[model samples]
Target: MNQSTNPSEASLHAIDYWQVVKNRYGVILLTFLLVFMTALVITYVMPKKYESTAVVQVRQKGTGIQVIPGMADASRYQESSSAMFFPTEFAVIKAQKTLDAAIENLDLVNRWNTDLETVRRTLKGIVDAQDIRGTSLIEIKVRYNDPKDAQKIAKEVAEAYRERRKKLQGDYSNQALDELRKAVIAQEDAVEDKRKLLSQIIRTEGIIYWGDPSVSGGPRGFTKADDAESAAKAYVDLEQEKIQLESQIETLLRYDGPQLMNYASGLSLPDNIIPVLLPQYQEQKRQYEAMKSQGRGERHPMMLSQASNLQSMEKDLVEAVANLRETLKAKLSLAQEQLARLKTRMDVKEDDAVKQGIANQNFVDAKNDFETAQRLLEQLKVKEISETMQTKITEDPIILHEEPMISNVPVSPNVTLNLALGAVVGMIFGIGVAFFLEYLDTSVKSLEDVERYLQVPVLAVIPKDVGVLYKQSGMSPDAEAYRILRTNIEFNRKNPEDNAITVVSGGAGEGKSTTLVNLAYICAQGGYTTLMIDADLRRPRLHTFFDINNSVGLTNYLTTELMLEDVILQTPVDNLYFMPSGILPADAAGILNSRRMSELIQDVKQRFDLVLVDSPPILGVSDASVLASEVDLTMIVVQHRKLPRNMLMRVKQAVENVGGHVIGVVLNNVDVRSDSQYQYYTSYYTYYAPAESQPMPSPVSSQPSQSPQPRAASKKTTSADDSKQDLY
Candidate 1:
């Protein structure tokens, strides 16, 4: 026996999800239709609307006027210009004053028939403004129930904005011009005073007086010639000092060489010695030459003494000359000093000329400034006259183009979207319901469920409303299923010697007795000697179904002193017999478990080809289990959708616990037509239905093929000699 690895997968085989869809297809179609119709109705009932838009450009403008001191400078003017345009524009766009004016001009409150509060709200709704990104543009749009009304409102908003802008510009420009005029006048007066002071300084300083010199030239107060003479004398003195320093340096260089020559000649020094001693002799010679120029000699008595002095001096000079150098450093120093003095004197004259030139330029600048101020004042006066003459649109306001418009096709009543969504939602709900029903269903509906839950092979499926025992009686097509079950049982049992079968179920109404009777009928019709025993003593039903006498049945045989032949009765069907529960036994379990009962079952097994015992529901009493213990194979009959799974399992367990081998399960009363998956087998009955006019199988054999054996020939036959014995 191969077992499934996953019991859940095995269980799923019983519940076909697609079959659920097929069975409940009407529900799904109705759901989709309802949702689609609802969407269409909602879409048809919605309202429509219209929209209109207007466009406006925001431009920046600057007035040639100043509001603060030095505001005319390009940097300050640029900043002020930006400030003027932005603030005024924002005020025109957002100010309640401007909005109210626009409302009044357009007669919006009257048109809307609104109060002050409503008028404000209406204006706000109709108008909107925002600076276009990275540009100076604005868009105004409005929505209304009527397209003409939307266009009218949009145009009115634009006109109101233009009027307000003109007024704001005029007021701001006039204010700026007035302030600028006063500042320019004040600046002009200050510039004139600065020029006068500069002219006075030029005259008093007695500088070169390059322009208009006669203003101070009449004075002997200061003369250019006198100053020039002083500067010349100072220059000459510095030159003379420079010349004397140069002459002393030149005289030292010229005489020093000749004295060194005299010293070298007088000593008769070697050429190498002369060169080495020459420098030292030159120093002494330089001093001697100075003294000789003042009338001293090398060989006078004074010269003789001087010669000795010279020798000593030469020795000292040699030491001094080793450290001395004729560098001419002092001459360079004196010449640099003289040159510095000359440059300083020249710089002084240049300074005076530069100062006079700076003063002249200052005077000219002041004159020009005064003239420019006069010209600006004239221009402002002209502008003021022009502005005063012109009319200003004093109530302009900014307008925006974009507005919130309700769509004619409402965004909410979207038919296609809603229907699609409804379909998905409904499918989810339907599948949930299907699975939920599957979870609650406890009956054995399919072979897979019976096998998985009961752990038994499905012996047969009895089609629902089978008319086998009624219409054609034994010749009905429904009898075929039972015949198949009989064949399966014979094939499944390993030993032909152990052929006593007991049929049982979980509950009373599961058709166990009916199954036994019909199975016996089919076996007998197939030429096998078959007997059905009504072992359900609690409620005996087999005799009533077969229209046989049940007063002298199994209970009578067990309790009375009677022969087995007296209790058993031959049925109307051929080769078939019924032994009903004679009378309800007080202790059916005890009676069924008696040694006599075992003997009876053994006798029937040998005498008959097949003996099917119909026992009571196993769960309701101990009678079924007691009979199960004595039978060769115990088969359970489960009515589809009648017994719960746990109860069915309990019935199987009861039989097994009593040492009975459960051969298989029979699924009874299955609705084959409605459940399509089962229809393949049951459909044959409908397609090739047997005619109601067919004859029933004969109760007795048509012809005897073998000799009828006496009781002595059977291995376990009961004696039938006492024919008058009381069975009940």
Candidate 2:
């Protein structure tokens, strides 16, 4: 059964913790005072130390040229600086190099009369460095017994760091400048080598170099005399002339007579004769057609003469056309010959151009290389000059803002802070101890502890030092506890006739007898006939409360043939009776376990309304267990916070093992004032106090009276000493 804590249970737990603290307040207070006083004494006796501080602003390292660009550590840059930068700087300030420099500056070896290592160790111990939050400022602090030495050490350390930083920065700058100069010299040599290669190529190739017209002075490609283009143009013209001549010759040969004359007339060749002869042939033919139209016979002389003239003109035209065609053939032959000559000339020029092209390509390549080298040389020269100027510009990285001075007031042994811390720690430690002790103690703390462990209801809670209730005048507030016990016993019993309850404890002095006496008195006052039997033959204590004699009681009756009425005596309190243990018996458990003791219990139950029995601690002996078995009900008297929970459980086990019926437990001697959780159970004491004017009647008579005889006097008669009564 796992239980979760509700708000009510949580509140109960808090109250339980507070109750523990209240109960052990003395231990907590003692622990707290001891710790607090120790801190005070230590603070008072510690030696004083004076502090001197020097303030300086440590700027982040600035951007500088790198011999190898993009290779510098980013932590040196102001924008890229990280949290570790200042811490690293602080470490540098306390480094051995800086401290050695400070020691040498102060001549600490001779002044302190120590060796070099000792002085360095002393300086390291006393010096401290830290950065101001959200700033680049550093504070160098030194502490010593003498204020002047502290001041000197603080100032010298800061100065040493500044000087060392400047020297390092200068060295880095000079190294970078040297690298830049080497780069410039290398670039110059590269440019000169490129120029020499260009000159060599020009001398070998025999090409004309065109100087660059642009401001950058880059290479312009070389040129050569080229006759191949002019030769090719002349050769194409001659070839076209030959094709036209051949076309005219073919036209003259394919055509004849009038068609040939018409086609030859259209030709405009330089050497053709067709245009000169064509017009004469046309006139002759016209004359012939005129004769034929006049109807002249073939034998007529005029017609014959006209035909003869036309035929002669035709022959002259044919002969002239043949001569013109032969001239065109001759002209075509000349054109072909000229074309072949031009081809040979063109080929010769092409060969020369190809040779010049090779030389030009070599010259261009060398010129490009020289131009690239020259450009790089210019850039390097500019960079080198800039770096040379920058090396002379020095800026200090550390600025001393506040010089160190001797402090008059000591800074160590802060009394107020130490005392406050001690108080807080002591209180926490005390609370822890209180809770630890409470955990170890398993005694019954409240009614819950009783019922939860014993599985029995807590019938009542009896306060501490509650004397015999029968002797209290009027109404004592403490009597209410016993009355509540009386009522609980009556209700808890299943049968009203089963009213024989023995009040027993796990150990002696747990207030078992006192609780029995009180409860019996309360029951009598409530008008019930209650009987208290002292069955503890080992150590009888009930007779002491009433100052009654215990010479002849329960023991005498059980050991002899005396009747029960001889032991039972009525007290002065109304309706209350007692039976004391007459003599100390050696075997108390044997006597109490006998059939005679069982009969006495049954006889008393029938005679009285309620019978309360008192016995010794059940754990120590078997007498209480024997008496417990003889009774109808057993009531356990448990002292609060006295017995361990396991022991209480064993007490209940002792009774039940003997066939005794346990009614419930009575939590006796509770201090409700300190344990606030139980206050509510006993809070009505003051409010219910008896008024001075309303005092109740005294239950006991002032003077001794004659003892009344029992109702069953015939069956069990008492001895003749019944008239001698003692009321004191």
Candidate 3:
């Protein structure tokens, strides 16, 4: 029956984050409210800002075609660098000159009543330009205190940038014309020199070209370089024709006209015999055979003449095809000879051709320069003429793609967004604080907390304000917790007869005495004949509960040769008795640890169905350990969230160290009203009515003049004389 519970064997409880949050919810709520209120106040004081935006298309110049009414149309839609243009455009829109132009055009300096530098700085500060990514459009936005001003500034800035671009392009055009005019004069001088060289070459080298017969000698784009090129082309054509003729003749010479014409234009060649012979010979021979069938003599003239016609016809067809093929061969050989002579002549003129190519190249360069100059001269003259009448205007590369749009609503002090952000931040910070406080707190708060730390089952959860259970007229909800403690003690004790249980705590005012008396009363009501000994000799309260004089009880009985019946008295409750600490003995531990005290505990265990000894906090005195060693079971009574877990373990260790059996624990003074989670401890509240009446003969010493002194007591038997005489 002496079962030992080892602390090492118990599993440590994991600290639940949510449990900590629930326990310290009030602190979290307060922190959250403070943060949220601060954010709200800041939002309330923020100023409103109006914003307007204008969109402009920053196109690569000349990508968009232009329509001019008359004259030759210029090449438009030319491809250029577009991918790299957007970032440059963004910079240009915020340039100092561009912003200055916008300010002057809008008369913003006077309107703002500011100096030019101040106006420019302010405009730049308010302006923001962003190019739409992967696109050529730029958004020019302006923020201001006034909506009208925002809109006006946005529109004026876009127009100013457009005018600036047009002026740049016009200036570039004039500079380009001047450069071209210089090029034309230089080219004219070079062209005259080249013409004189060409005349000298004709006179000195007699380099005149006789036009080629096979070449189509019309004027190509480079007509000046075409003379020798035409002749070379004609000779190439003759050589190609000669090769074709030779291949055709070779195929025809192997063919007989009577055989399959393999090379006869669309026909193919066959065996080296006449194909024409087979049909003519077969026809004549069939005629000869038919005439022989008429019984004509062997020397018949018709048969002989038919045979001869076959032979003659075969010979003529063969000769005709062969003769035609021979004629083509002769013509091909003659053309080949002519091509050979033409190639020889061309090779002899290689020096002349190289010289001619140089002169022609020079002429072409001079001509191209002169032509380009003439075109530019005409365009510049036309531009000058147009400018004299009215300055020519060209389209701007960056134009206003969208009109400026001004919003009616202000964009600042967004209440919903601010509130949402505030809420999220507040919750996170509150949770952090909650966990921090939970970490700092070391009190045991729940059954799990106590069991995990102390490695003992919680016998009961004695709710807060336990006075209501005793004073109320009807059955009270709080009485159920004491009953549960009694039931758990009966069930958990390895030996049911181990009824001498001491209820001890780590510190004074942890409700150890109160819990012991209540549990005894409940047990007595359950027909257990419970006895409560206020071995808390340091501060006797059990007899005070019965209004029995506490000056004569356990101390007197243990310290003197007194009878146990003299100190023990029946309580007002039917089967309950009270034993008070008679007096404070100076040698309290010595008296309590004496063999007489053990005899007394053993005697009461036999007499009462249950004996609950209320001892001083074990940590505060050695007397509680002496009492615990004498009892059958040691039960620690702890105040909820009051005593640190380490102190509770110390209490348990103190009893077990003295060779006492610890049944479990009783978690007393739980605040069930504030935390509904503890309500489960007395879940049968609906079934329990308030106590109809206080137990009969309630204690006369109910009200205390002052709190009892420190739980350690040491005096003598003189203090407990009144209750000792009842034995006589």
Which predicted model would earn the best TM-score?
2
Candidate 1 ranges with C-alpha deviation above 4 Å: 1-15, 20-340, 343-424, 440-449, 452-455, 473-477, 549-551, 585-587, 590-596, 671-728
Which segments of candidate 3 are over 4 A away from where they belong? Answer: 1-21, 47-60, 63-88, 94-126, 130-139, 144-391, 394-410, 432-453, 461-468, 507-511, 537-570, 580-600, 620-623, 639-647, 668-728
Please report how far candidate 3 places residue 326 from its true position, in Å: 30
lDDT of each: 0.66, 0.81, 0.71
lDDT of 1 by residue, 1-728 (tens): 34655776676665577666655566656665665566566666754345565667654333333333332335424634574555455456645776677677768777878787787776576555555566656666555656666666666666666667766766675776577567657766765766676566656554443443346553232344445556667777767767765664554445554464443334321222444555555565566677678786656565565566668766655443332323334555767787788768756765665565565565546545555665766665554454443323232333343443333432334567767776776666666665666578776767888889877788889987654363253357787788668877876777766779999999888888778888887776665666778898888888887676688779898988877777777776656766778988788899999999999999988777678999888998899999999989999998876888888888888999999999999898987755666888676764575566776444332322232321111222323221101110
Ranking by TM-score: 2, 3, 1
Output the worst ten-in-a-row residue range by lDDT, candidate 3.
719-728
547 Cα displacement, candidate 2 (Å): 5.6
> Who is ahead in TM-score, 1 or 2?
2
- Which one wins by TM-score: 2 or 3? 2
Tens-digit lDDT track for model 2 on 1-728? Answer: 23665777888888878899998887788888888888889889988789999999875555544544434545457443565777788889989999999999999999999999988888889999988897779999999988999999999999999999888878886887799889889889989999999999888877556676254464344333346777877888888888888888988888876898899888887666667767776776787788788897878898889788878877877887887888888888888888888899889888877887777777778888899889888877776776666666666878999999989998887888989988987788888887888889899988988999899999999887889877876678998787678778777888766889988999988999989998888776665667889988888999999898999898899999987778888888867788889999888888888999888888887766678999999999999999889999999999988999999999999999999999999999988878897788898875786665885544332222225644221211222122111111
Worst 10 residues of 2 by lDDT: 719-728
What tens-digit string does per-residue lDDT give for candidate 3 at 323-406?
Answer: 556667777889989999988766656655687677655544544554555566566555444433332444567768789877
TM-score of each: 0.51, 0.75, 0.59
Residue pair clashes in candidate 2: none
Backbone clashes under 3 angstroms, per model: 13, 0, 26
Off by over 4 Å in 2: 1-51, 60-84, 107-127, 143-149, 213-221, 225-358, 409-417, 438-441, 446-449, 463-474, 535-572, 578-600, 671-728
Question: How much is the lDDT of residue 587 in candidate 2?
Answer: 84
Better of 2 and 3 by lDDT: 2
